[model samples]
Target: MIDSIIFLIKTAFKNVFKNWLLTIASISILSVCLIVLGSVMLIVGNINLFIDEIGDESQIVLFIEEDLTVDEITQISDRLHSISNIGNINYKSNSMILEEYKESLGEDAWLFEDLDAETFRNSFVFNIKDLEKYDQTIYEVEKIDGIAKIKERRDVIERIVDIKDVLTFLSFWIVMIFVIISMVIITNSVKVSVYAKKQEIWLMKYVGATDAFIEAPYFMEGIIIGLTAGFIAIISQIYVYNNVLSPILSDLGFINPLNIDSVMSVIVIGFLVAGAIIGTIGSAYPVKKYLNV
Candidate 1:
């Protein structure tokens, strides 16, 4: 059994190298497929990250009248906490807001020295537990005592989420289209390789070579091609992401930038999967057509 397996591997490797054009063609197609898939994965990851950032920054700040005492504010805080969908209440004191503006102003901080934060608005910041429950959360918080106003930006968040959902759906179809194209390209390339060796294949069959004996070489070649394509695609993506994508995104002030490690992992997995599927399907057509029993 071991001998048979070794023979198959050796034959496959020899054939993969011997048919230089087909081997290269397979690798190229696989590389393109992997690259496309990697791009799709990165897009999805970024959209998800953006959605998260939007959610984090989405806080409903309610401004109360300064006449309210500390006990009244705490009373408001407790009521906000009592609501079901409300995650937590962050009370920004008059002094805290003043300090923030002072930091922002730097030397100009003295401009606001005569003023007071209480003159603006003593706010109760509402963080929702789930974005889907935002409207309901706001409706509940409005009923609380000493809560002057709520600026829950529901429309903005909903619009962004809806657009992203559409993009996510579109990505699925795009992925399917590319996968089909990859399969077709690999299949045709392998078929041509098999056709070139038609005479040898016939002779081997006549001399009692089994179906496995004939097909093993193709399967093995597929594995080799697949692995190579996947690895190369991963490296290429990582380079492009760091050198190209990162700089552009940095200019836009996106947080933490795009993580190369995550992108690389996605690329690697996509390529490896593409390699296996392509090689297997590509060879299947040839085996069915030429290697009967």
Candidate 2:
């Protein structure tokens, strides 16, 4: 069994080298496909991270009417607390708002030194636990009496959500398209190698060689090509993501991109597994058609 395995490995390597051009073509095609797929996955992942950051930081501010009674304020607080999706509700007095505004102004704060603190309204500022319920929460808050105006970043959130959805859809189709393309290219590559040694395969079969024996080397050839392509793709992806994309995104100010360390394992394992599966299927399909002998 050990000798048979060694023989298979040596034969696989010989076949791969003998068809070096086809192997190179297959590897190049698959590497490009995997790189594109990895990039799309990274972009989608960062977009998701950005969405979560936005959701966590997102707040709705309800400015209160100046003439509201203490009882009305208490009732408003009670109503807000009763909402299932609301989280971390806090009331900021006009004075607190003024102080915060001053802090935000930094060196320019003196320009507003004479400004009346009462110019800012007392407001209920809170986060939503479920952004999907944001519109409903806003509608419920609007029905409350003491709220004079509502301030929210809903427009921005909605736009981001739309972009995420569009990208997710595109990524799914892109993966499907590339998988098909890779399989076809790989299948043709294996077919050419198999065709080159058809007479030898027929003689081996005539001498009682099993189908598995005849097919093992070709399958190994496909797997080696896939593994080489996957490795190259991974290196290229890491370089582009860490050196090129990460710097550009970090400079964007608003984006909080994920660190490569956080997702490196996932990318590596996913690409390798996907490549192996594609290679196996590509090699198996072509070899089966020629094995009737």
Q: Which is the leading candidate under lDDT?
A: 2
Candidate 1 C-alpha error for residue 177, in Å: 2.6
State how far residue 267 of model 1 sits from its true place (Å): 3.4
Instruction: Please give, for residues 31-140, the per-residue lDDT of candidate 1 as tens digits.
Output: 87777777776767776777767787788788876789888888888887778776657888878888889899999999999986666677878666567666677777
Error of 1 at 226 (Å): 1.5
Give the poorly placed runs of model 2, Cα more than 4 Å off.
62-124, 129-154, 251-253
Supply every candidate's count of residue pairs whose N, Cα or C atoms clash at under 3 angstroms: 0, 0
lDDT of 1: 0.75
| Model 2 local distance difference test score | 0.87
The top-ranked prediction according to TM-score is 2
